[model samples]
Target: MARTLKTQVCIIGSGPSGLLLSQLLANAGIDTVVIDRKDRAHIEGRIRAGVLEQGTVTALEEAGAADRLHREGLPHDGFELAFDGDRHRIDLKALTGKTVTVYGQTEMTKDLFDKRHADGQIFFFDASDVSPRDLTTAKPRVAFTHGGESIIVECDYIAGCDGFHGVSRRAIPADVLRTFERVYPFGWLGILVERPPVSHELIYANHARGFALASMRSATRSRYYVQCDLKDDIADWSDDRFWEELATRLGADAAANLQTGPSFEKSIAPLRSFVAEPMRYGALFLAGDAAHIVPPTGAKGLNLAAADIRILSRALIAHYADGNDHHIDTYSETVLRRVWKVERFSWQLSTLMHQFPENSPFEKRMQRAEFDYLSGSETASRALAENYVGLPLD
Candidate 1:
């Protein structure tokens, strides 16, 4: 027998976006039920980008989910850009009066899971065949199977926060949906080790070989990446090989301090910029990666998801509290304005930091010139700083 339930909102996906949105709505006294196809352990184990903008921190705080984040997250004031065998710093706090927090996405997800788990409404590690129905109507319902039993959740609104591969975006009719995308020729091969980061702040390096980044999850856990052919397999990259390539890219001074250790995790992620138009289709609203994706170069993926949740949560709250749908009507437009800016920033940073196989000598010189201009020009540095910390949420 199919079990039936009712809530003010039905949220698909249990990622940080879905959990954060649910927590925010719950804070506003709105009822929500969350569903995901993966189990809790599997969800929390996925390593991802660690940089968080101030707006994202505020959102987590508002949802009462920032306790662990603040206690464990590292506050970074600036980061280094290495090129031409030299290092230049972008002082984020000095330029924008703001700093980003470096807390692993895995840890952040853990925090959300711990907080929401006590509420007893999240269905995880169990959901399958989840689908949204009657999204064109004022009331929408989500149906899925769990524990070999069918479940139907009817709600006034549905949130699609499942991510780029999720079912929510696919729920939108083919005629009504439009997509824009750019898939990069290379991918980032990343590793996680117990060693401390070489530098307290992140280092984004451009070298004759490719681009590399030195980031951290905590005081003792380091995350590093180097650009590689998109077709490159993880098996070809041993722990020693990755460390050697990273050292060469970071230049001498930074490389001299590099630590070596066995990697606990390693993976390759293809870079891409993707966006789906009109994030809302009647009562079904898309948020996070379900709506757009930016290359990780600018560290905008998670922050963009947070931005989407912030906008959609506010709109939903207004609809329920004052019966106003103004924000709801303009949800897609409002989010996309900020989304495109972040996309441009990500695209620019990826272009500046990576070596393309198709690059001619002229193109390479142009890249070098752009790097030199950015390194020497305070105005250019400030612009990068502003976008990196993030633009305004509203």
Candidate 2:
């Protein structure tokens, strides 16, 4: 049997982007129905970026889902960048008058989920074969199967908040969609453990060996990463090995306060910068990873996604509240302008911090020289801080 439902907006994907969009729209008296291929538990359990730009925090606050975030998130005024056995602090607050919140994406999604659940927002979980149809028509529809029943959701607009591998982006015509990408030569091996972080704020380190980052979920729960070969297997990286490599890369000052323990979660993620052109096709708007992706070096993944939703929610709200399509008409252009800038920062930081495979001595010297410049010049350091704190959502 087939069933049909109607809403002003149909959001595909139940991640933070989709959830935040739905929440914001609902607050404006607009109704939305959310759907995802994965169930709620699966989405909530995935480990992801924890750094939240000030803009992201504001977006959550707008959605009224920052209660727990404000209560539990760590506020970092600055983070350390290391090279040649020394750490230089980029005081984000001093340089940009802003700070980033250290709240796990997993937890953010949970907060959004809780609010959506309380609001009685409709969601289809474990939805299979989800497809967006009639995007060019006045009415856009999403068809999917859930709980062994075929369902269709008809709406004025469709939001593809689904990630890179999701179906929403695929809904666009192949020839019409152009993509840009840069796949790095190495991957990051990250581990989450039940222990205090090596530093209260995040530390990004570059060493002769590789790159390492000491980050945290909270004051008590730590997350660490080290650059590694893409071919390396998780089974090969024992806790002792990971800790030893991390210490070597972070240097003695940070290592003095190191705490090592058995990691409950471990995984390796390949580094890449990807962006899909024209975030909108007909009436379907793509936001978050559905539109772009950045490397983890700049900690822009989740924050970038939230940035997308912020613009998107505002545009959608305008369309209904005042019948303004200017924002919607230029959503892709406006968002991409910000997206490319962030991508450049993430790529630059990744190139500066990581030990490239078969990197020449000259390249290494260049990296050292650049770090020295940043360490010496407040202008250079401030530039990095400005991007780290995040650019305005203009």
TM-score: model 2 vs. ground truth: 0.99
* Residue ranges of candidate 2 with Cα displaced over 4 Å: none
Q: Once superposed on the true structure, which residue ranges of model 1 sit more than 4 Å away at CA?
A: none
* Clashing residue pairs for model 2: none
Encode model 1's per-residue lDDT on 1-394: one tens digit a residue: 7899999999998999999999999889999999999888888988887999999999999988899989999999999998857888999999999999999899889888888877665564569999999998876899999989899999999999999999999999999999999999999999999998999999999999999999999999999999999889899999989999999999999989999999999999999999999899988999999999999997999999999999999999999999999999999899999999999999999999999999999999998998899889999999999999999976
- Looking at model 2, residue 249 earns an lDDT score of 92
Error of 2 at 28 (Å): 0.6
Clash count in backbone of candidate 2: 0
RMSD per candidate (Å) reads 1.0, 0.8
TM-score of each: 0.98, 0.99
Looking at candidate 2, what is the lDDT of residue 144? 95
How many clashes does each candidate structure show, in the order listed? 1, 0
